[model samples]
Target: MQAVNGRILIVDDDPIQRRLLEEAVKKFGYRSKSATNGAEAVRIMTGPEAGEIDLIILDMVMPELDGLGVLERLRSDKIPTPVIVQTAHGGIDTVVSVMNAGAQDFVVKPVAPERLNVSIRNLLKTSALEDEITRIRKHASGTLTFADIITRSSAMERVLDLGKRAASSNIPILIEGESGVGKEMIASAIQGSSDRRNKPLVTVNCGAIPDSLVESILFGHEKGAFTGAVDKHVGKFQEAHGGTLFLDEVGELPQDVQVKLLRALQEGEIDPIGARRPVKVDFRLISATNRRLIDQVKDGAFREDLYYRLNVFPIWIPPLRDRIEDIPALTRHFIARFAAEAGKPQVAGITPDALDLLQQYRWPGNIRQLENAVFRAVVLCDGVQLTAHDFPQVTSAMDYPAPSGVPSNSAPIATPAPHHAPAPHTPGTQISEPIQAEQPQSGFEHQAPFGFMRNLDHDGHVRKLADVEEEMIRAAITHYSGRMTEVAKRLGIGRSTLYRKLKEYGLDDNGKDAAA
Candidate 1:
């Protein structure tokens, strides 16, 4: 599915033209909210839904507030939504005036659908690219702050709050999250938010370095300190002096190195190899690891003392699957970036169905996985918008039917049946499937189609409330792969209530909850 093209606000007084424009916008794969006049348009743009409106199609002439007036109001309010002005007169002066008033593009009245779509696509693409470029610059300059984090989920908001609090002082911070949940980005933001802005944020991936080289690499060595140490070397700690040092995958450090790391954090200094005395280094420490350091400590793989020293202020970033609400925004951000990098200016947005497919999958690799997926989709996309067909791997994993007529070099994506089972005779084995213990006790043996609940009974009347409720419970169980906790949370009910309903409906098989 193509990403949601964008939300457009159409402002015009003529009812016929408004309806026509609305139809054209819908046909162009964009969702739109309409305003009868310019004043109403301004209100919508400044109201709570302002962020949702991506572009505006304003009539040049309207009562109370004209196109130029609306542009002035938006500019004064610092609302930068791209605008396209339309007028019946195609005078050069009108075009120039609209351009000067901050409209991105101008169109003649009774605009051709093709031309209008091109304008909207170009404007949205330009806006997305500009935002992406700004983010890239901030990230590269080590000036990225919490405000630069692209997120819309409440789960991430808590993470940001903790990061902000940790940034106020030189407290040791340990960022805990799965790989690719943006731990390094969090560390960078903390550094930028603190007094160390514009300072070096030296990152060392502990796991990526060889065990023999880890010690020397982290602490500078004098010339001829070892057999291969011919030249003096500066270590990560010294490089991060007066700034921030981010130790990624710090759990992988050798036990001997752990002792030195603990001492360095505790003493605010390090003993360089072959040095006359220990060198005092002043730097903030921020460590990140995908593994639970406590578990490593329990297993005696990581030193307990070192773990405690590094974990002064623990901030756990929720995984992408846990913060599913952020997928759409993150998807768009990645699409914009990759499209710009790939020079695919025409590739603007994704279809709603495509976005839905992405949200349904559990991204075990977190944000990194999503970013790669969007990058690949953008590269594969031949049209202006990305569709479900572009993400064949994801679809196949979910057992979704491959879109008709699109060619693929990989194995065909499977089609799910009404019972939520993949059709047989496919070459590729199914990755995972929804758990089904036994036939549901509700006795609607003929299952409603997968992903759709029955709204009417066999007699053409509305289904019984209890039956519908039972179907919903069953569907939720399957959709979440029998993870009762997630199912309950998504269903907006307490776990106890969910379990009771499962027992009441005879949907629970013994021991499923224990494993889940």
Candidate 2:
């Protein structure tokens, strides 16, 4: 069992149930608090002493204020505490309703200690995961920094060394990387590690701002300088005095703005649009770009001098896919983080298959996409584990062949061999033995199989496989909007094979199926 780092709040009118839950949580090494009803729970959670409450287990059938009403009130009051609903009623409809009402999980009482522990453990794990992701983002955006930039890869290690040396200087720095890579993060880390760490680290998105306002936004304008100018305004440069200014997507800046920027960097002063004299200022410049500024300079779209100035120190952030080994760590980190923020304390971890799918994807959007995927999975997933079904969109987006070369449907079904001893044969008698099946020779046989399979009981009895293939096929066809080619790709089968299977299963709505 994992060490619990959060406080559990048990809300129930019955003293026995409250004590039962408190003791159960304490057995897992977690601290506990109790409330008699929804009103009391709300008061305790919102009061000055609410700092210790990390999660709540609310009884759904309480007197005066029921669980649903409490949920509504909490939502209305903007209390962010995570709540798991408990009730004696157990049914699909009631569970769905409570889940829809923002309850983390529904437990049928009398509460099983193991079930409660599973819920609480998963939630805390997810909370920690999300916190770490947010911390990474904040660290990348200049809010936090440490010695986390080191890398084992020689190329990245060299880059880290260079970044460290650059951080010690006051010269302007440029970071270049692909979209979604942590260029801005590296820039922030540099600022945080520099002597100017105490001062503000102002960031400006050059690509997001309008071209017309680019100059005026970076260099302040005097009153009456323009028609809309009501008073003298200070620009980002002036605001960043004695601090660090980060220009994200610096390659998008106009050539004219680049020229003025070059002048400011060289002279350490800026002349307002209508001002007669230039004002001296001191600040470090950190710029990032997904585009190649050297190419932009060669194309006459960027100032050569400005490029050289910003290039005095350079660093590049690698994409997430290049560091595939780090996916497990990153996934765990993000899951814990978002779980805490959403207040869902019962989500434990991703299933092994789900984690495999995550690691296999190319991650075109890099860490941002991974974080969003985990967030979506955590919210939509049921139970303690996140399954592949929870991330249907992600699985559907990937176009890789199934791990086994065989088609998804044709994949061999698994049934446990009987444990009983082989039947005895008469000595020296002409006896025939049941034909022994040939073992699979492929390397894939050594690895666990993918796709749906029949469940087995503890006593080793084979259970019927759920017949959802038709529904899955229909959904796949509808998802592709009746495009056979797309549906085949998503299902990881050839078009001809998909058509054959659809016809065999009577999944095709049209009278005729696609030609082989």
Candidate 3:
């Protein structure tokens, strides 16, 4: 979908200037949010919707809190959103003051759309590059702690708490989770938070290794120990000496290897292939698996004694759907990372409706699937903000209908992959393919006109008034660029009532009423 190029907060006291700037932002393929004065702008920059805002257009002449004041507040709060200050008189003194106060750029009051677009684009590009650099540096340092994890769910909090307690010791840790639930990240965090924080973290995926080579790969091998054994090898255990050894998919290890692994854990040493004696090793053990080790033990696929050793301090991570509360933060994090990586710094955040749609789906592939989806959306999206139409696969997989007014820039809908053989056809007879029949478009098909809301359901029955009201409010907010005053006035509701309805409907930026 053609997401808005970016979300620009317009902090201008003058209604005319705000409206004009909003229109210009829209024209430039970006979305705009309004703040009556600098104070409101600061509130927004520090509030729940902060991450979604890619840039700000600040007017210098606002009362209560001027553009310079806003810049100071943002700086003190460490908000990195780029700001473009606007003043009626673009004198050198005013420009210098704003820049000194942390403004990224300055524009004359009657800012031309072209000039404004260029300024916004350049700042976003620079900011994205800086963010990507910081992320890479943090990863390379291997100091990723629990704080680096983006989560707001209580379930994840418990996991982090358990992980923190477990990190205090070198006890064998078994992190159990479905595939892609970030088991490796948890393992890394454990190692990074442990005494071995400055040491190496050697990881081996047991499931990805061949059965014949599992033992040799984990415990090392001597030259000529087996066919084609050309040189002495230091295995994962040796490589992780004085550090940590993370065995991912540990449940997949062969039965024979499990015995040696148990012995190594118990004896604090390993007997490498063709070695004269056991070699001492000092490494922390962290194992992860998608399957239940208990089940594997019962099936005789895993040794029971080895299972108990690894399960000493088990930590289970919940799947994505169970922690839907984390979706907004995670989505924003991925958007930032992928947007930077894709060199589309202007691609800032996803619309609230898009976030809601994502939170509703059961992500069977978990965080890995979510990460990949955001990466794809960042690449496919042409606008600054991602919309529901950006995730066509998610929309199609969940059978979700596209929002009524948002136009899609996606490919044509393809039929699902077949799971069964095609039905038999008569010889020399033409048979109409049922799968080729016209299907309702979810997010990929060319959309209908904009500014119209669907009043009826697919069954032709009138939709509930509550649903229609919520949809109307959402559209009004998007249409007005989150100017609540304008939205309430247009909807014939008082501002307080509008805010109340927003709370009741759970339609604020973070998918809930931040004001409430």
Q: Give Cα-based local distance difference scores for all models.
A: 0.77, 0.68, 0.74
| lDDT (10s digit) by residue, model 3, range 408-495 | 2111112221223233222221111112112211111111113434434434455689877877777666544456787799999998
> Which residue pairs overlap in candidate 3's backbone?
4-384, 5-384
Better of 1 and 2 by lDDT: 1
Order of candidate numbers by lDDT, starting with the best? 1, 3, 2
Strongest candidate by TM-score: 1
Q: Supply the TM-score for candidate 2.
A: 0.54
Predicted candidate 1 versus true structure: per-residue lDDT over 1-516, tens digit per residue: 343456799999999999999999887767789999888998998897886787899999998889999999999998888999999998999989899889999999788999998898788877777777877798788899997787766667777887888899998887876678899999999998999989999999999999999989999899988898899999999999999999999999999899889899888889888888899999999998876565466468999777777766777676676677678768877888898889887788887788888887777678998999999999999998889999987887677322223221111111222343233221122111211223111111232212435444544455688877776766566555456787789989999998888777765532123324
- For candidate 3, the clash count comes to 2
State in Å the error of residue 337, model 2.
1.9
Candidate 1 CA-lDDT value: 0.77
* TM-score against native, each model: 0.72, 0.54, 0.61
